[model samples]
Target: MYQAKIMALLFVAGDQGIKEKDLADLLEIDRAALRQNVEQLKIKLINDEESGIMLSQYNSTYKLITKSEYSELLTKYFKTGLGTKLSQAALEVLSIVAYRQPITRIEVDEIRGVQSSGSINTLLARKLIKENGKKDVIGHPNLYVVTDEFFDYFGIKNIEELPKIEKFEDYKEE
Candidate 1:
């Protein structure tokens, strides 16, 4: 059952990816049954939601990963203090991209109310922002998505895990 499969998954994971044939042979089950079991395990992991584990398939190889959502737990966190190394303009551009991604340089300029070519270029070169491909409508300006490295550098796993920033209203009220 699921319990047996789960145990097998954990044991087999140490070798990197578990081949379906290997699991079937070890468990004395047919490929179809093994497939069903693995699918069921994937569903179980995903549905648990609370657990930070994920069943990711690298091409055809399968393994249980840390979801990459709790990356901060596995790596160093980003610092926002002095001597930390991000330039003011870099921070500004990063902010824009992080908050307004799938957005282009034109839109970013509009929001920041200034030119941002240099800053955007720097971000791209640094791999903080990436080319997420063309927009759907009109000119199809390229979109951008933050990278896993970004999470690694910032010590945050997922975007939602970013530290809650004070609202503009809160700052205005102060």
Candidate 2:
């Protein structure tokens, strides 16, 4: 009962996603009840082999997103031109997120010495990066981190597998 309603609300909420609090309020249920329903829904979706969509939780927000297995088909159907390759700026942002995970957008911008919102959005659309949590600060900005897709894309088992970064002085013209 609640599961179906929650799914409908998530579908309608779309990419913006809905916070657990909001879902609870809308469903007129307590947090415990909502959690139980959400958990059951997650299990059902995961076990449903025919289901292309799954429940994705990011920073307390829940969203209905297509499973990674359908990425190729979705890319072809949407023809978004994302299949070619990532742009240079996007790659840079990805690298920054990969190395400094749980970093905020403002921090990334400061490191890059420019605004990185666009690049961050591109990486997010590609599912290579995702919002991990809110930074403990004034504005509570979202912290970014590389997703599992990132690991698979790079063909590495873990972040430790990435090559070590050498100091700039190592390659200085002498």
Candidate 3:
């Protein structure tokens, strides 16, 4: 039962994955209980011969990922452009990153007034933005900046080519 809920949360978390602490808090269970449930879920997925997905852990975050056996099929799907396109939220995040290069995820969230981890992950996966380095702040959060791919995607040679915010204000109705 708890394993099912954990799977649902991981699925909703997308590629960003979820931290163990956050997961435990959401499930209203202690860390040990969460770990036990996650371990069971991992075993269940691993033992299911027909299951194409598995739980993967990186550092303290956990994500549901397709097993390597399906790598070829997944590659073909992405090559054919069948992969999901960016959502509105992702575009908004991209815009923020484009204008504010070397900004942290927390800063982006503050500018947008919402959590942007999913969108940030999407942009990172798409190669539109990348972690330039870690900020010197307390947590040393990653600082993201537009990549060369972003230039190609936007058809702009440089960041300065992006339209000025004042230009948009000029078009606003009085």
For each candidate, what is the lDDT? Answer: 0.71, 0.88, 0.92
lDDT string for model 1 (1-174, tens) is 754665457545532456667667777888788778778877887888797876666665566776676787555544333424776777887877786677888888888896776677767866888989888878888787677767777888788886556554366632
In model 1, state the lDDT of residue 68.
75
Cα lDDT for residue 7, model 1?
A: 49
- The clash count of every prediction, one per candidate, is 2, 0, 0
- Indicate the worst ten consecutive residues by lDDT in candidate 1: 75-84
Better of 2 and 3 by lDDT: 3
* Per-residue lDDT of model 2, residues 113-170, tens digit only: 9678868887888799999999999999999999999999899989999867664437
Rank candidates, lDDT, best first.
3, 2, 1
lDDT value, candidate 2, whole model: 0.88
RMSD of 1: 17.2
Single out the weakest 10-residue window by summed lDDT for candidate 2: 165-174
**What TM-score would every model get versus the actual structure?**
0.47, 0.52, 0.75
Question: Candidate 1 — which pairs collide?
Answer: 77-155, 78-154
Ranking of models by TM-score: 3, 2, 1
For this target, which candidate reaches the highest TM-score against the unseen true structure?
3
TM-score of 3: 0.75
Q: Using lDDT, give the best candidate's number.
A: 3
lDDT computed for candidate 1: 0.71
